[model samples]
Target: MVSSKLENEPTGKKLPRIEIRMLSFDLVERVEIARLLTDAGYSVRNELAANFDRFESRVMDDDWDVIFVDARVPYDSVSRALDLVRAIGSDVPVFALVDSHQENQADLMELGIADLFTSDDLQRLPGIITRGLEASDDRKIAIEARRLQNEIEFAGDERAVLAEIGRLVSSSLDIGQVYDQLVEQVKILIPLETAAIAVADVASDSVTIEYLSGRELPGFDRGRVMAMSGFTSINQLPQFVFVFDTELMEQMRTEFPGIRELLNAGVRSVMVAPLVHRDEVVGFFATGTSTENAYEPEHVAAVEQIAAQISGALANSRLHIHISRIARERETLIQIGRDAAAAHDLQSLYGSVFKNLKNLLPVDRGVIALKGEDGKSLAIEYVEGLDIEGLRVGDNLELLESSTAVLTGSQPVTVDNAANREPFDLTDGKLITAGLPSTMRTPLRARDSIVGLIAVSARDDRAFTQDHLSALERVSNQISPVIESLSLLNQVQSLAAAVETTLDLFAITDLQGVTSYLNPAGIRLIGLEEGASGVGVDLKDFMSPEQAEIVSSIGLAQASETGGWQTEISITPRNSERPIPVELLLVPVRNPSGGPGREVTTVNVFMRDLRDREALQVELREFVLTVSHELQTPLT
Candidate 1:
């Protein structure tokens, strides 16, 4: 019959379960031991083995809190059972039950026994098992505490490194310096065989390796540019990627050919984090090692933090560069305006414009065209760095699709590839033939009308961007009015040249009768000295007082009323005392809008001296009178 555990024991508490493995040759001894452990308020499962084979099998098959051996069994057998338990590497406590005279204490102790139990003192076995199990629990707790301590230290070190990296990012806007420091700091936490930072250009769909360090990688180096489609696919990465072994590296080789280079350089692990700013991934931060499974989850988290810091620094750097470039562009624009205003002619103005524009744009060729007088075509006024067969200065080009678009859109237009344009204009065709592929054109507007177009071209495709176009538009707005003014001035200069050579006396005066200009003939007719200007003289000073009154009251009044007046008038010469007769023509020049109630700008006076015609009439009269007298005397 099985002996049950004592129910009404001391302390009135439930017993604990104890699993024991015992090696014994006698059934009586195993049953006695089992009964003692059960009566001590312990629930016990005892496995009794009678042979070494059985004992070794029990030791290998199941786990026990303790093992027991009867010392009465052959000394060698007991020793062998203990040796088997030791060889299997079990930590179970092995206790030997001995007769008091069976003296093998020193030998059993040498064989690694936990304790000795005499048959008389077998009541202490339960307490010994409790002590042994308690010691095991303490060991487990110590091991877990050590693990937690290591983790805390690692966290502290990681935080310190992250703080250092954050400080580096904040202290420098130079990304190169930041990257160099970042690699050094990250090395404290993660082993690195290769490190790189690449910036993405979304407009061009490309990635350029901006910074590279560590082991040299073939086909992956500083300043290397690769298309984003089949390359690293950095633009498509989600937060971070870890290629932790050679097998994973090979699996990623097809999608990311850059991985092959890493593998060739003996790299077996890689960690990549996207550099994100303002919810956009602007670039990537990557690190690799030659050891497989070199990075853990915590290392990945650290790299992500580093990448975030880099992203912020890169954004600040880019913003700084952008602002600096804008400030420079603004200064350049101011200088261009000054050059435009100070230029004396269109050629000089174009030269200055071209020179100043180079500071802001990549211009390989430039052209300026004005709307034709007919308004259906454009006349090429200025051309620089462009030499096409049929296109030259003073050449007429029909309004084509590209130029028409600039005028109609009333904004800047960009041709990314001049060679790819359909229905190409003469300018586009010429540009393609010249291997110039990029072009930006902006309309020149003045007084709310599209007056002309200014264009710039480059040798590379997609060389000009929206920013460049915007800059060009700003320049166009600044110089368009000046161009119009210059053109008008040129026309006025030409008209003045023609008027200067005419034989008739021409004089211009303000509405107050103050003369502002007098041509050569007018100067000679009024008897002014050679090389003397007639400006600031009163028009009435050249006429007799009576004639000045009539001209001021009647001639000026009629000219203002009917747009012109013509009559014979007497004008006293400055060097002659006699008054000379002349035919006077007065014309009123009105403001831009000439209608009733319009303001007069100036009065133009044209005069032809009549002295020679009067002298000829006197000669003819004298000859006729002499001939009549002669004929009458002959008749008497």
Candidate 2:
């Protein structure tokens, strides 16, 4: 029967659940110890030697707080339990329940028992159990603290290794050579049976063994290409730690088939350190051994640190063939980010991105396209590479007809030789027509979705290398959010621009009588330049003394009513002493932003200049008079 929770016991959250494992041939002895531990608020488990197979499995799989054993039992002795625990490397403490203190005391003490109590001492069982649990908890804390300390030291070492690798990346030009040199340098720093570096091709979504050292892998060859399944390990391996036996290796086959293959070929242990580029798991730096228990946690950490440095060096090598631009690029990114952040509209934001991208790579033409409304089409948002007039903003193109198909497929696409590639296969058809040599397309990724596509073209054959592509990708990541923000800002600015340039004079005055906005026509009516200090001035400054008196008393009071206020009034300009007659319309602007009762910070005012209407009336009167008096006399 399965064990169930005790009714009187507290939940695991409030108190630690104690698990006691018993190993004894005598049924009476097992019952006594279990009942004693249970009465003391512990969860007890019985492991009678009547069925040794099930008993051994339970001891191995479950975490037992303390194993109480009949030390010299005929069928299942405490020595047998000790032998099993040592074989499996279990840390569970063993306590011996000896019959008497007289027989073979030296042999019993050598069994590595945690504590020994005479069988007659039932009174000491409670005290013995309590002390054992306290010691167990202390041991657990000490182990965890030791693990954390090792991690801290490992992190420090990784930083130093990364700094060294940074220097190597800064000075090196050849990526292959940098990786080869890194593998050699890692061997000197870390002990391993074999170490190899595998690099993933972004376009191919496949991995190839780039560098190899140590014991030559029997079946696996250098430059062997395989699917993404071969490269990715199931668990996010931190310590490159996998100890292979038959059962453990087989269970892991589905996630890491290639690693399993190595284990099957008489390999005992292995660890994988990922070669990451811009937070991406591009490939891995792997180390394996033929001897079991050969690698430790510290070794796992050491290899990972070396791999990280190699990854950074490899990524840096690709940026510029002969020139080191990481320092300059870092500064450019900071400045460009500052500039991009100020973009209140799409045009300026897109202009900044494309202009800065040219300094980063050889971008003869650039295209920023996005997924269309219907979900099946890709629409061009901005174009730069060639004269792509047909693929203008809002022009919807079929996803299959463009290189953007690969981007949405969740991988990058590159065309080294545009002449041999299909014209339609490329995102922009004009690339081939204009004799452009190479093109690369990558997804413009945002937080929750792939917002758009970014494609770049070059004029020279195979112009865009891995380093150029990485730089472009880095640029894409930096600008994706800015693009999204700018897109939203452009829509809002368009609406605001329409209101500002309208024929009527408009202004928003706050509750405190300060103007916040004076539109284009409002600025003209106020006789001030666009950038002048008209915005912070009071509404009374635009009205004559008499008009101001009427507004301060009658107009303002009437506007407070629910109907709002509208009447013709005389207005004064800042530059002129003369007052002008104009019709005024005022409406209260509500703040739906928060709070109660249509709370508003400003009132929107519209004033239509009456001068044009007044002139038209005069012209109509002159025409009527001339026809009635002058034309009647001319008829003779």
Candidate 3:
């Protein structure tokens, strides 16, 4: 039989050769295929269709444009050869050459054969070759197009995942943020039914499921710790890929069921990548799909890259947390320093420390204890925002504890738990009664001497770190100077005797008009007996009726305004019927909280008698009047 072979030209010029390889059953079919393609301008060759293994390699290796197979071969069956090329993952097309129709002829067509040809149709051989070349070319173009599309889609998905990863690295609050972003991004790489990230704690010999996304598996809430050797085995391997049928899954469950709960629900295939940083395995990211054999090699590689990124991201998150904590501590101490600088008394100073305490450190309840005036005990000087039984202001306790060491200029005493153990005995029952189980006592120092103690407390299990102690030390340092200044007030008061002994009359008064203290000179000037009771008397009572009303107005106005005012006024002494002149100066003390005399606490009054000046003025007036009357007598 001869098939139609269309000749191009008889012009002796050789056409470009088209190469062809054919799989034939016997010698007859081999010669037929060779001549058919040869007359059609294709250079043809023949191979004995020896075995299905060699058949698959040749077709899949891209050497042939079209493969022609005989319906029967000496050693192997046609159906088996066709199955090798199509049922598996090869893309080359195969056609069958049938000699006669059989009972299974229709069944052979359904076995993924590309086309069928019979011996009677030998004339159509050239047509079949022409059509096969055209069809193969079309399929190659389509496959190339699909491959490019997949690459582009993968690239787009990578960009989106990396963008989200950038956000996680830059703004992550905790490791949980990194976990959240990692699991969500894993689903983009493959068909994911469920995904999880589990971190292994070596010391605890446990695996902690840190984050999970998609379908929830029973007994796999976050933070659940499992005692399993599977995580240990996973850590030993850099990566593990598991694909299971129902039988294999059951086998795995029997072998390692302890960690089976950590696996994804309905998982048929899963890829696990180790989260490694600096050569240490910190955790693993598990991505699972319910579809059988769903994960490919490329998917495993993609998950490996994500796990690597998460390792670095987690480290950065910890650094960010530390930096934010330091920044907050600095701002809080600066505010406390400003408040302490304005404190003029111990009470306001204590209030400022407590108000800003929580800004720098955790404080649920706090107290400031200082050595009492009794000199043998420490007293509760300042306390609030805490409900401690048997503790109040002025309550005394023996100063024999680690806090007493603060009086000797020692470091602060700290306790992690107050119920069973504490640094000092004096703090006994204080924490349990206050509902606080953690306590820290920082010393308040003035002029290199311990002036008081600051105690901060929190709920049980609140462990204070060294960083927290450092921050508290910064706050205590800022308030030390204010305490030093207040502690020196007794030395300041010792100078008052100098003012008292001077000939000047010095008096001190409250914001009201009544005098609080009167120097001896002031007492004598007001006609009160020396060392007599003049403290309660108002200065207005000794002034003449007109001067009293006028100077009283001047003094009241001086109290209302800040600074000082001075005037000379006449006063009728209580012991004498005549009025005497005196000089008076009123000065308002500074208000601690700011502004002018609105909150002023006291007024300072200085007085000096003007009796000598008034006597001289009277004599001069008499001399002037004498001369005037003499001149009016006409100088005879």
Candidate 4:
């Protein structure tokens, strides 16, 4: 049958469209029901239930907000149609329509009828439908509110976990302790069966596992160093890498073999966040689980937050370590200086140097070589560790590639593999033969000149780093001056010994005529005790008035201009009544690069006693006179 179409006209308020199905045997009653619902702002479809097929087809065709069945229809047909609605799992409220008060209201309710009404009460249908829909909307609102409350609580917990992690990171400079606490806090946020921190070593181009928790993976434990090339490049990774399944893990396995151990440890999923500081990736924070697809977007985000906090703390700890190391190196340098100053001999000085240098750098073998007198060869002053057949402490070694390079460049040189390079001298060949492959050498510079070289070696290749080279260079710079000063002191001591034993009087007087040093001979010539020091005596005290006047007027002036002056003088001896005649020479001692205008620092006085020579000459003349007088007497 063709259903009547009815449309609601526009009103002051918009109302929700409600669809209703009408069941009746009479076509007149169906049209009446459709008109009433249409006027009341509901869309309606009418179904005839003369037989079950017609009623079931209409009910299954559309989703209805309400189903209306008239009691005038055959009781059996209405009952069967209600049964059909219930069998289809439709929750549409069903209202039974009665023309007379003949049907039992209780029986209709038992059959799942929503309400009982007749043609007189047909007007109340719209109000009943409105209240039902309002009640349904209220239930939906309550469900959504509970879901939002649960989400808010979950977010609050996550924030609490992050705040605690931040607190842990800021609490200590000890990185290990902070990491341990950090992993525990992270476990609360993510379902982690394993967690680890790997630190990258930029100098060595390697990564080392610094901390591990949970299941231990073989060959990938803490302190294990692996080449950085064995893992995925940190720069290419996202903020956090999430290997959610075995498929993705397999895809990443080819480039990162380090993850294979995780798989073997029953870790099927993983999340990794790179620890970045100052825009550079320095390490990684990783978490894994035994269940595939265990990590969610929220878990990835949590790890990233933790990684950022850890990165800042790790950077601070590393900086602290670096500064402490520098402080220790400075202290080592100071100790080396003290050692050099207190050393009594060359051997003691070298021993002190080696002992102090070991604190700053690796020194399995140490050698100290100074330039020879000829300036063409280096004499080994000290050697440790290497034992060569012909190489000894006093052996002279020709300037070779390594030492020459250090001298010429005035910088440190490092040989990662000494055996791989061609030997330039016997010392280099001996080092290679001794199985020492790594070496660092720096020039020992003194007074703006390369005086020697200091070298250290190790048995392992690539054992020394640029920092070691720099440390050796600093040590060389300090040691060079001490060595030079010691050499000058030795020379001065030998010269003083010779002057002390000479018979000729040697005296050093300041420009003001005060004696600074009088050698033993000079002291004896002045009639002082053998062990007496003449350091505070005046030069004029032991000279005659005329000689003192000559020295004050002409001797000092001539020496200042011409570097030396000589004169015959008489010295009055303190222990004797007579005066001693002597030939005196005065020489001005000036700076090393002395010129005519340079100031004289002191005067060197050389005196030769003339009394003995004069006495000899007198005796010879007397003998000649006596012999001549005897001859004259005999001839007369």
Candidate 5:
């Protein structure tokens, strides 16, 4: 029946062309099958005429999409052919020819055969083989589609996970909370025995653990954290891992020699990613996996994305916390300023500024100093966490000559590595000697003038960002005004000395007639006790009944507007038993201006001795009378 069907098939364009490889033990059967398939418009690669030893080579030379294995051939030969196909990694499908009596489908499937056809089913062989070829092509397409879909899904999942972590980090303003969430989320995504984040302490050339996840690191020290050498340094942490194999000499020589022992010590495979901010490698995240090839390219890529988010989040969180701290400190410092304003003692104000700064900023030690003449020395005024008696306050320390050379020169200065920089002192070295590694010094400036400086020291080696620098600048800027106010009062005291030369009793008062400045002459004239300061006394307290009323009225009018008055009044003299009349002159002293804002105004009073003026008048009258009498007598 199979032979009749093959013969009846027309060999024309209407019928599909099929290539057949017929394997048979008998030459007659091979000839019959070939003649039938050829008559059916099929090409045949018959191996019956070939020797068994050269059969596989002959079959391999032909590029048939399917191979038919005859049951008559030795099972070992068929197995060898299947092995060859697999070894070559060919996509060709193998079908087995079997008898109905020996229908061992399981055995054919186990032998790596694609399908089986019995001798009785020979009539349907062409169609079955054609369908098998089509099915094989479809399977290939399906497999490729699945592989591509897997890759796309993997990439999309990575992006989604990274986005979720980013959202989680940004939603929280708290740094510790963000870190905790980051660690937990990473664990949920990719389970690991231990994970930790370390940041580069650039000043010290070491990385500190910023976040930790999973199991506690074995042999982890609290006071002294775990550190890695060459491969684990901040500069090189971006590399995933460099593995070595001692058991495989070829692998050892080909990759990493003498590195097997290093891997065996809880360092089989290390996955590391760097955290970058402002173009700097601030830190790195690392995890250790026990399995070889534990981290693939996709895993590394995911970690890199997470690390980027962590870098940005940490930078933002730290900045936020820093701003919050600075704002609180600013409020406290402003309160201190208000308190200082009410004080007459400069010592109190200096104490308040220093105390507030030390309490607010994270510092192991601090010092407050002012620039001396020639810009050489820093006159230390206040200090904390230092040996006070050992340090001199007013002595010259010989600092930088150029204002531009100094870091804290009318601007906030931060020295991350202070010990390695210029104008830094190891003299007292309490900071350096105490193993302090970081230092920041900000110059106090008021109205563009460098009034003083504030220095903070830390034991940790970390560079200050622009924000921290700005915060310290603000703190110093706030205190500069207080220092300027004190310095102004000192200048006023020196000017008061020159005013003492006027014995006519000069006095300076505020807009309210409150005597703010009184020279030695005025103090003595008012019968004030010796060495008594008259800063708070009113003009009415010093003047006699008549003089007080006249001075008060004129002082009030002058204080309101730029007005002056000259009047005569009676006053009780300090050294005399009688009441002496005096002449008083009042003038409103306008502040020097024309640069920025409204100027300050004060009242200046000048007093003249009335007794002396009266005596001179009497003498002039007597001289006139004498001259007149003499002239009249001569005329008569």
Candidate 6:
């Protein structure tokens, strides 16, 4: 028999509201009984005139804690009504209303009437009502306990299936494998016609179907992709990105147009839940069933719980991939630095540094330059990214010239939108023209002076944080000292190997004005006598009258105290018309006894006819300042 009270089952609140149904032979008695019951806080539904049809409807539609049947009704008519109630199921504990003077009370009690009571003894009605409802409530509780036991057994059978699919998803890190297992497992657990896994694309902010299973529904485009903002995913998905359930299939379709055709094609139900990571939606799972009312609230809730558990695992896998790529790039940079240090020559250093770094870092171009004369001008030793003629080799770009300003300070300089700024440096112009909206330049310094620079550019308006800037700074710091050492080693090797063939003058002197060592050019420059030997030869003997006193007073004295000194001294050659201004640098040599005794010192003297170079530098500095000031006028 179909359960008639399926929709009207008493919940916790209704359990205490006593309900009574009155079946009587006449209208007056039934009306009186209903009024009395209602006044006593009992809900009463009456069926008068002994109509068996009315009684059956009342029994099927209403939840009656107690049934009041009049014993004065015709036997056959009343029996028919009683028989209908019996066929409907379960003993409802009917109480037959009898008069105080009625005969055969014991027989009536035995005739399936749980209790018989007169109308005059209405004081006992409250107790009867309470007892009946309690008894009915007890029966309902037992029925629920048995139903729950059956559901638990069914769920146990499905556990094995759920476990197998869960194992597959957990073992496979590939997204395709996880999606395939999801669809297959859902089909086994619940009867469904269609299923799909949709993941959000970070770049586009759109959702695309990564996996789909089951046949296409008739008269509909079953597997059509929905836009990210559409109803297919949002209506079914919970706002919390964890778990939720609802059973309004028809209402969902009416609210979202894209899924209307699917609903009309006998696919009446759907459930969806988001796959979340770090409190954000990474993806989602959606399912559709062809049978009407296929998914209950419990079914939706279970699917949501499973999605929540697996989302965190998938997020971990994604993070691992990102870290692996970054580690590989760092290793490649270390190898390049090592290779450059091994070059042992300027040309080799240029080739290794440029070629290897281009492969290691993502950039459009690079240039290396050395500071010339008090950080005034930079000589471009190497250039990459375009034709060589496009770049001016030896020139002074300003200290605050666009993103390349890293050479002026020990920091990384970044420019996100170079085009918006007026008067930008042209070396990075190609990157801007090609739509590279961001750039980073790292300074390479030696002995606290900017020696060179390394730069990288990108095509997106990306914000680079302090961490990225610090990483580039660290990379440049490690390479700068190694580069300086390699250059110094090369200089030492060149001098030792070509000593005999070198035409440049070399000289060494003792602290007491005695000449210790001199090459052939040094002897010719000073016009030394043929008989003069190295030992006990006063270096003051080579200098003219004025030069002799200047060296004795200033050169040797400062060399002893400061360990090194430099000055320009006038040299009057034998036939020269005017005194030659020769640049002299004195380097102190360590004493063999390890004391502060400056027994020997070396001086490198170079004579340069720099009558115009000094004037040009002054003119260039004045021109640059004037132009920069003029350019700033309109910008303000």
CA lDDT of each candidate? Answer: 0.74, 0.64, 0.63, 0.71, 0.60, 0.56
**How many residue pairs clash in each candidate at the backbone level?**
0, 4, 1, 0, 0, 3
The TM-score obtained by model 5 is 0.46
The candidate, 2 or 6, that scores higher on lDDT is 2
Tens-digit lDDT string for candidate 2 (595-623) = 45645445666677777876544543343
Residue-wise C-alpha lDDT for candidate 3, range 1-636, written one tens digit per residue:
111222355776543233434455556766777777778766554555455666666656544455667665532467666666665665555666775754555766787666677777777777776786667668879989999999899978977886777666557557675565666666677678878777655555566676788877776666556654753364454445443444555567756764365343566666667666776556667766667777777776676667777776655554677798888887778878777777777788788887887776677777777766565677787785776666778777787654455454323333423433434547576665556755666777765667676777776433344566677777767877676566554334444455456565667776555787777777888788766966887877777678767656766576457355767887777789887777766666555445433455666666666767755555434432333222211110
Sort by TM-score, best first: what order?
A: 1, 4, 5, 3, 6, 2
Query: Tens digit of lDDT per residue, candidate 4, span 140-249?
Result: 59879998996787688779888998888788886777777778878878898889898776557677788999887776767566776666664464345544466777
* Error of model 2, residue 586, in angstroms: 99
RMSD of each: 16.0, 23.4, 19.4, 17.9, 16.2, 16.0
Residue 194 lDDT (model 5): 65
lDDT string, candidate 1, 180-239, tens digits = 777898898878888989877766777777889898887775756667664454446544
lDDT of model 1, residue 551: 89
What ranking emerges by lDDT with the best candidate at the front? 1, 4, 2, 3, 5, 6
lDDT of 5 by residue, 428-497 (tens): 4545556665567777787777766777766655434444556677777776777766666655554445
What residue pairs are clashing in model 2? 240-271, 318-467, 365-385, 366-385
Model 5 steric clash total: 0
Off by over 4 Å in 3: 1-24, 50-69, 72-81, 99-108, 175-182, 232-255, 262-265, 318-636
Candidate 6 lDDT tens digits, 486-560: 655665454434332433334455555555555454455555555444344454554567876776678767865
Worst 10 residues of 2 by lDDT: 627-636
TM-score of each: 0.53, 0.37, 0.44, 0.51, 0.46, 0.42
Q: Ten-residue segment with the worst summed lDDT in candidate 5?
A: 627-636
> Which portions of model 5 show Cα errors greater than 4 Å?
1-175, 178-293, 297-330, 358-360, 373-375, 388-396, 400-404, 407-416, 419-430, 488-517, 520-636
